[model samples]
Target chain A: MALSASTLKVGDTYEEQVVEDLKRTQLVQYAGASGDYNPVHTDEVFVTKVAGYPTVFAHGMLSMGMTGKMLTNYVGDGRLTQYGVRFTRQVWPGDSLTAKATVKAIRQEEGGHIVDLDVSTVNQDGVEVVSGYASARVDP
Target chain B: MMLEIDPKAKQGVQLGPVTVTAEDIQSFAEAMGDLNPLYTDVEAARAAGYPDVIAPPMFCMRMRGGRMLPEVPLPSGFMSLNAGQEIEFHDEIIAGQTYTITSRVADVYEKTGRSGPMEIIVRESTFTDAEGRTIVTIRERQIVRSPEKKI
Candidate 1:
């Protein structure tokens, strides 16, 4: 069902805590699924030996997808007109994350009602891993 | 012999014609650990007014299902990371539909920040549905730097 605009205030918020902390194979699975085979994401030995990193880190899109989950949980899939994020920090294994989207504005646009949101994801350290915004059409 | 990429590798390239399937949508949602019914159950979607179950907003990122070339090639022994992303959703994507996406290296430059010398490549991708309707536009910034180049 379309979101009930009458009930969502400008400051209303929706949040989700990821069920899994960081998985070891997520990057490789994502690499296979997304086809972003950048070795920095999948090949740990390449990173540790050549590029020099402790181990494989989470893909920014993985975290963004998690944040997208948070939004979809609240607004449902296919509801967003625009959603974006800037990678702020790298996410390592064992780091827990929380994604949040808070309603920022509500207005009318041609064909539907538009709702703007301020979005963010933070890690266990409370450091922002990614931050951005989204605008969606909430059919009334 | 490593990853010394040619900067031209990513110029005005066509990325995909990946067909969206129920399995594709499901795996992505599972990877994201998001079981939102709108992306999982067709009946649930029908109950919610959609003709079929749809993909999440971020699903487009994985729509590039093949080897996508980079606009600016990086030297081996260097690592790259996503700096940021900007996306505009123009339309909804439903399962069993196919979407073609084209991408180009929009910009390549170097910046010395709190970190150090870093090469930044900006890439733009546009996703269009089978009927030629625009679905989404994505802009990505990738930061490449030598592992030793730190503050």
Candidate 2:
């Protein structure tokens, strides 16, 4: 069901698990899909030797996309007006990721009921990888 | 502080006229660990009223050329990071469609942080159908800085 301002409370929380024991090929798949051939995300040797990273890591966009899934699954695809995030930390392989979306506020704006969200993605160790805000028009 | 790399008014810097295929859509959905039929199954999509299998919302990240921003010239010794992003979906990007993308440097500014100093570059990329209808607009922020000195 679509969440609306009437039904949405300020402190309501939503959570989704995006990945578990994340894989290396998933990054390859993401690289193939996104056309981001940045070696830091794909080549372990390049990352270790050239880029100085310990190993190949997940794209920040991957975490951001998984976080977006939490929103799309709840609000339905194509209903989000704005979704954004800040890349706070590197997401390495083997990290389990969970996206947390909390209702920050509800407002009636421009004749539409909008939901404000405090969104974040955290790894298994509870390290915040990405955090930011997202807003969407909700059903009433 | 003055920006090292100044911003410009770019009407549209063509990045892609890439085609989106069903495979492209499915691969991205799979990578995100999403099992949504609308992004994968044709029959389910048709039942859901989409003309064909649709793409996930963040599939826009997969659209080619959105990553071309960091190629811009910046101050030497600066390491760039994907700091933040703001995306607005104007139209549902469907599979098997061709869209062109263009991006421009919107702003550049410096901020002093705990790590010392950094430059933030802002960019706006637009995706449009061949007919030029709006598809999506992505505003991304990139942060650049020198490697932190180990004490």
Candidate 3:
């Protein structure tokens, strides 16, 4: 159900564990689906021997995409109007993530109720992986 | 060493007029581990008022590849990583609609963080439907860093 602005408060929040033990194969799946064939995301040899990273890492969009499931679940389908994020930290294989959304405002726009949210996703150790905001339509 | 990006690469380069298919939406949603019915069930999506199964909000990101610019030559041992993204959704991406994507290198700069100096590339892409209506806009930042040398 969509959130009801009449009953929603600015501090209301929703959270979810988006991913657990993120797998490298999942990154390959994302690369195929997203059409982003960047070697750094999947080719372990290239990423480590050539690019010099410790190992293959998760795509930032993957983190955002998983986090978005949390947002859409909270706001309801077809309700989101705006969503954006910054990759604050790298997400690695075996990392688990929790996404959170705190209501920042409940107001009306263009004759409809809207909810603004502060969006954040943190790794198992509590380090933020992605940080951003989102706005969605709500019921009055 | 500094990287050199071709001036022409900064201009908007068109990518596709690919049609969105139910399979595409389903695969993408499945890949992200999002089991939202609206993304996979046509009946559920229609009940929600969309003409067909709708893609998730970040679906536009798939079109972000097929590089808009030629690769910049980085230091021999440096790596480029996605730093962030800002997306604005004006409409839901419904299956059966054809969309075109145009991406450009918006900017390039440098900054120093705890890891030392890094180069940032900002790329912007716009997704428009067959009717030329803007569906979404995505601005992405990529960071280039070289590994530290051990003496």
Candidate 4:
């Protein structure tokens, strides 16, 4: 059954399972595949000394990817139409990151239903590291 | 050998006026395993208030994915890693629209840690539609680490 836009409402929150301890190796693999090998992500010393981070951190895109996965899974396949994000802070390794999306509004336009989502990522400290919005066409 | 880039020296160094097409967006969607309707379904998109099918938000990165050559003038080594990207959208990117990108080196800094020395480069990109209207602005940070440092 397709989930309709009307079924979703404002203040609806969804959370993704916390992956324990995002590793440096994962950052390396993302760097290898995505061509981002910035030292803050791969070099522990550089991350600590230069970036002033405690340890190497995860790539912003990697965190975005996880958030994207949550949306794709919740909205169901092919329902998401437009999505965008902004980086607010850096995500460090060993930090428990949670991706959350709240329905902001639902409107009828162009013969379909458009659902706008307020999406964000919060670390264990409850600080939002990334914030953005996504729009999707849901079954009316 | 560590390649050092003075961020101040390269400020506003435009890296792209790269043109992108609908086909490229489609190909990238496939590569990323994203099978969203908006990326592939025109009728569905039109019904959703879009004038036409649109690419995923992250699809903009593919514009820079045309394999860079070894002889290319990238500041670092032959290999370029995609450290990460940040995007802000002003409008949807539709099919058949020609887009141009302009990127500049934003910042460069060094850090030493348990592994070794690492160089960080921040690149800012502006993407404009065919009409010259800015569609999105992105800040991509790339970290180039010395290969000698092994965790």
Candidates' RMSD to native: 3.2, 2.8, 2.4, 8.3
- Candidate 1, RMSD to the unseen true structure: 3.2
Spell out the clash pairs found in candidate 1: none
i-RMSD of all predictions: 2.0, 2.2, 2.3, 6.4
Model 1 C-alpha lDDT per residue in residues B1-151, reported as the tens digit of each score = 2234455555567755777887888888777777788788999878977777888887888785433345455676566777878899888788878888888777778788777678777788889988888899988877777768631
lDDT of candidate model 2 versus the reference? 0.80
Per-residue lDDT value at A130 in model 3: 95
Of the candidates numbered 1 and 2, which has the greater lDDT value?
2
TM-score (chain B only), all candidates: 0.86, 0.85, 0.90, 0.76
Lowest lDDT 10-mer window, candidate 4 chain B? Answer: B64-73
Per-residue lDDT tens digits for candidate 2, residues B81-141, read 6777988887788877789887777777878765577777788888899899978889987
User: What would the per-residue lDDT of candidate 1 be over residues A16-51, giving only the tens digit for each residue?
Assistant: 786457887776777776767877677889868876
- Candidate 1 regions exceeding 4 Å error are B1-11, B46-52, B66-70
Query: What local lDDT does model 2 show for residue A81?
Result: 78
* Candidate 3: tens digits of C-alpha lDDT, residues A6-111: 9999999899999999999999999999988878789999878876678988888899999999999999887898898988888999999999999999989999
TM-score of each: 0.87, 0.88, 0.92, 0.55
lDDT of each candidate versus the true structure: 0.78, 0.80, 0.86, 0.65
Best by lDDT: 3
Tens-place lDDT per residue, model 2, A2-73, is: 777788898798998889999998999888878877677899897787557689888888889889888888
Question: What is the overall TM-score of model 1 with all chains considered together?
Answer: 0.87
